[model samples]
Target: MRRYGQAVLMLLVGAAVLRISLFSALYLRYVQSGLRPYLIASGALLVLLGVAAGVRAAREVPDEDETQDPHEHGHTHTTGPRLAWLLALPAAALLLFPPPALGSYSADREDAQRAAQGIGTFPPLPSGDPVDLSVAAFTSRAVYDSDRSLKGRTVRLTGFVTHGDDGTWYITRLLVSCCAADATTSKVEVRGADAPATDTWVTATGIWHPKGRLGSSAAWPPLLDAKAVRRVEEPSNPYEQR
Candidate 1:
């Protein structure tokens, strides 16, 4: 049972990995697209192993009844490891119910305590009304740019809302390198009106207030004086790629 089950579990795992990697959006929630090739390769290998195991099981002769007849013309068949079936749980879960990406809850937990990097000059912005910017990019400009680069522009930032104990609301977005495990969040204080429910996806159009102390790695983030807040559905890809 154990050995045969191992092969079957491997096959299922491989198929699930390939299915999510190739045909579904599930993998995008956990890791970047760069992992697709590796996932496909792993799935193929597992399937091959399972096929080999099945072939071996089929070719074996039947076992004799030990108690009834030792001299009887019969053979014994080997069963795979009995406990190897446990390995199927993860694969089954992933196949049936792939989880969503980290969101407001995850963002709320990760403080901006990451070691500072690339904290120098920022380039001028191209002309536009309500200039579009990612949450992370806006945070970087607000915190590190000494020139107040976001002074006049009405920037549009989209993220889920997170409520702070101090009665403030934040436009929060998680930045992930390759997966959620290493994700960090960039948050901006939302001012000008009452904040919506926590974890609500919103597009906050606002002007930068320069409220937080800038040019230093202070825990406080820059504030956005929100002129308009529109509730929106969560985006297909939740994490901001860093």
Candidate 2:
């Protein structure tokens, strides 16, 4: 039972790694920004514990007089062989078929929200080169005012789709603090084009135009000129890439 437990735990760890690697949003929140260092530290601790458990299990052996049947004792007392095979379950899952990215399923999940205090006002760009702004920035500004400063500026954002209302499509980028357990959602309402498939990664280059009012929430009223739009693979570290 101990061996089985260890095996199951190891498999869970492997699945987590697979999910984080393949899914960009998960990678950004949990592995990139805030919780990255802690995850590394925790990973090291887990490795040490696994090693200690393995060593102790290895040293444990049944006495000759303890069992009447040699075969039963042989199978029950040996730990390495039993636990070693369990690793293959995760390995096979990874190799044979990996999970897909977080898709439109989480569109309505309201994990994305901006910080009220720390997120300062959007600064004016030099207006020389194309300005780079995150979806978080746009969402923050939309809460306070619905101005056109963000209009006609080239903006870059990556996230999954949340929903579409009227002619606008709502997209979201998830910010994870630790594991998927503590993920927050930041959203952008895109206009001037038909909504892309929900939960797919996209780079939208457009001019920001303030449109209608959101709910009792802040006013985000911004539209993308949508000069260009294309789908891309989710990056290894999918958050702001900061």
| 70-181: candidate 1 lDDT, tens digit per residue | 4454654333343456678888888888777787778777766633654566898778879989998898888777777899899999999998889999999888898878
Scored against the true structure, residue 142 in model 2 reaches a CA lDDT of: 53
Task: Please give the CA lDDT of all the candidate structures.
Answer: 0.80, 0.56
lDDT of 2 at 124: 68
Candidate 1, which ten residues in sequence have the lowest lDDT sum? Answer: 62-71
lDDT of 2: 0.56
Q: Write candidate 2's Cα lDDT for 1-242 as tens digits.
A: 44445644554564455445444335453444565555545545655665666666567774454435647655545566666667667745653455553445544555333334433345665565356667766666555443435655677666665565555676566555444455455677776666777667777767666554532234443455666667877766554432
Candidate with best TM-score:
1
Residue 176 accuracy (lDDT) in model 1 = 84
In TM-score terms, candidate 1 sits at 0.84
- Backbone collision count in every prediction? 11, 7
The reply for model 1, stretches above 4 Å from the true place, is 1-3, 62-80, 114-119, 217-219
Residue 78 error for model 2, in Å?
20
Candidate 1 lDDT (Cα, 0 to 1): 0.80
RMSD of 2: 6.2
